[model samples]
Target: MIPYEEIKVPVAGGELAAVRWPAGDPDAPVVVALHGITANALSWGPVARLLAGRVTLVAPDLRGRAGSSGLPGPYGIAAHADDIAALTEALGLDRVVLAGHSMGAFVAVVAAVRHPERFGPLLLVDGGIGFPAPTHLSPDELMTAVIGPAMDRLSMTFADRAAYRAFWQAHPAFAGAWSDEVDAYIQRDLTGGEPAMHSTCRIEAVRTDGIGLFDEEVLSAVRKLPVEATLLWAARGLMDEEQGLYDEKRLAAADLDGTRLEPVAVRDVNHYTVLTGDRGGREIADRLVAYARA
Candidate 1:
């Protein structure tokens, strides 16, 4: 495993738990990464390893997830965006490469727009663009429908860490893509003692942020990105389904005309693997290196 350090980033109410993979060179570019709604900072482990110390990688467990779970909410995409901006300022970073995956992509979009001067190019992995949701469903129902099992897992109690690992082992998305990095990512989400362990993600935070996926704030932000963004979409979806989240049809409907977003399809990887699997991690790492060097 690549060496990393866990640190706390001071935000409004409390500290956001984060991990840093230091670059070999002190002046190397920095990439500030964000994780999915139910995921923690460790979710970026695979990509961090792939980077091989070429550039500094910093990933935060956004408020209400993992180490930041104690941080009170007002949690939503906008709140998370503001936290990211503050994080950059606190770290003394001018403009850094911004990247997000899943729900994180949404956060990244809002951050870049609200604080455009804080970020360079964006790397959106399988998220950011808003898709239509069923209008009849309530906020909770909408989250259940869109996020599916990930939301369900938030309320579950596990027998042990092994049980939680088994739970994810059964997920279709990780069928053949499981690795040490993936295992480490999931392990970090567990909390409490044996026979009663549960995920560290706060349900309120997930619910609030999940609703923001369809909010106009996110869509408007996507349409107003100040820097160029490369969207890396997976071939498969959250559950390794045939239809991935964003396709040409959905892209055409989003009307990305005035934005600097470019869509790039990544083959043979599902939504989860797009950041965890070797192929996906390498692709993302390559772009990060190029962007960092440029």
Candidate 2:
């Protein structure tokens, strides 16, 4: 079985929760895993387990989610990056690999660029590099497009935790990905009971924190950092033709100039399963281990 221990590090004015998966030594190369929006550190379990005794793995729940909930802030990418940096300082960690998944990847990129001395390398699982920033849309239109239907889960109060969980299962993103392992992970972050299940995530906090507010700043700084990095994106989900992260022309034009960027595409994974599903996580873990060793 994978071995881990609970760890709490102070960040800003509140404490953030993390799971520390120890390697053979304290001085070993450390890797900090940052989860996405609506997800906590546990989401990295499969990947962390695969690393085993090779490298130390520290996964944080991030502010406004899980044990880090209720921290006051804008919760934007910059804030998340700050909180992460704070956590590192609080724990007295230095020169570690920072790997972030999904939204967390966005934060990781910003953090590595903003605080180059704190991280050795950067690994972005599905999202880290610069992308198109909306120029024609207002804030309201942006929120609507960004949140889409997931906003309902944030705005509505569930009768009980069960109902919320059931609602999540109905989401197209997770239609066929739920299994006993997935269910257990989901159950850990839910509240209420009986007729409904509500997510422990603070919706307003997420909306405010989840938006990408530092695209230009991050992009400008990306070329300055000497951090080795790679991005492993799913073949489907946000990149699918129906709702891609970019238009074909835009995607082709976007590049990580002056930075070492490697791309890996998982054949059949989507946004959600790319981190949670067995095959997807396993593939990521393999890459992470190889990257860390190199």
Candidate 3:
């Protein structure tokens, strides 16, 4: 079975809950893995398995998501990066290898730039590079066009865990890719009583963090990345769309006149299953292991 300890890292006025998946040896290297805006710490489980003997992965339930959902946030990308910086400092970690998925990548970018000394090479999964700045679009518009049905889940109430899993089962990304890990991940997303279950992620936080992605902090960090980083994009988009969130054209365009951002494409996975799928998660974990050894 996958092994981990749920711990609360002190942040802001309170504490931030995290999934601490240990490495085989006590002396094994460490990496701080951040999940997507609406996701929780457990979302890192699949990938953690592959890095089990090589790296200790600490995945945080960023403020306003899951266990940290109730934390009062002056929420935004800035707050997230600050929280991460605080988490790293509180843990007494040095030369942190910060890996962030989706919106978490954007938060990592801000954190790397905000606290350059503390961060080592970054593994930015599917974000922090592609964007239309907030100056170009409203957060509401960004949310509707980008997150789409995912935002609808905030208002949706599932009658039971199976019902909630049913909702995710219908999602195109998972189509035939669902497994016990995915089931557990989706089931944990539910809250309230058996008769009425809702997502633990606060919609306001999603809205704020979603818009925060387009903010200057992210854009500025992109223009001047503080350290070496890798961008691993999923071949498919959020809805299993033909077009992924970032295509080769946008990636190429992003490269010219900007800091060098290494990019890799993971075939056949969408944003949601990038880490949930075995192939993609193993690939990401292998790279992370290599990063630790380097």
Query: What TM-score should be assigned to candidate 1?
Result: 0.98
Best first by TM-score, ranked: 1, 3, 2
Clashes within 3 Å, all models in order: 0, 12, 0
Could you tell me the lDDT of residue 24 within candidate 1? 93
What value of lDDT does candidate 2 attain over all alpha carbons? 0.72
Any runs in candidate 2 off by more than 4 Å, and if so which?
1-3, 24-28, 192-197, 238-250
Measured with C-alpha atoms, the lDDT of residue 144 in candidate 1 is: 87
Worst 10 residues of 1 by lDDT: 214-223
Better of 1 and 3 by TM-score: 1
User: Residue 164 of model 2: what lDDT?
Assistant: 57
lDDT of 3 by residue, 1-294 (tens): 397888888888688888888888988888999988777887788998877668999989899888788788789998999999988898888878999998889888889989998888899888878565555656687788768888888988888988888888999999999888788777667789978889999888899888777666677687677788888999889888878988889887676355756888998889978888888899889888888778
Order the candidate numbers by lDDT, best to worst.
1, 3, 2
- Residue 35's C-alpha lDDT in candidate 1? 95
Cα lDDT of model 1 by residue, 1-294, tens digit: 588998887898988788999999998889999999899988899999999989999999999988898999899999999999989988988778999999999999999999988998999999998877788999889998878999989989999988988899999999988888888899999999988999999999999999888888886788788999999999999999999998888888889887899999999999999999999999999999998778
What is the RMSD, in Å, between candidate 2 and the native fold over all Cα? Answer: 2.8
Q: TM-score of each candidate?
A: 0.98, 0.86, 0.96
Query: Any residue pairs clashing in model 3, and if so which?
Result: none
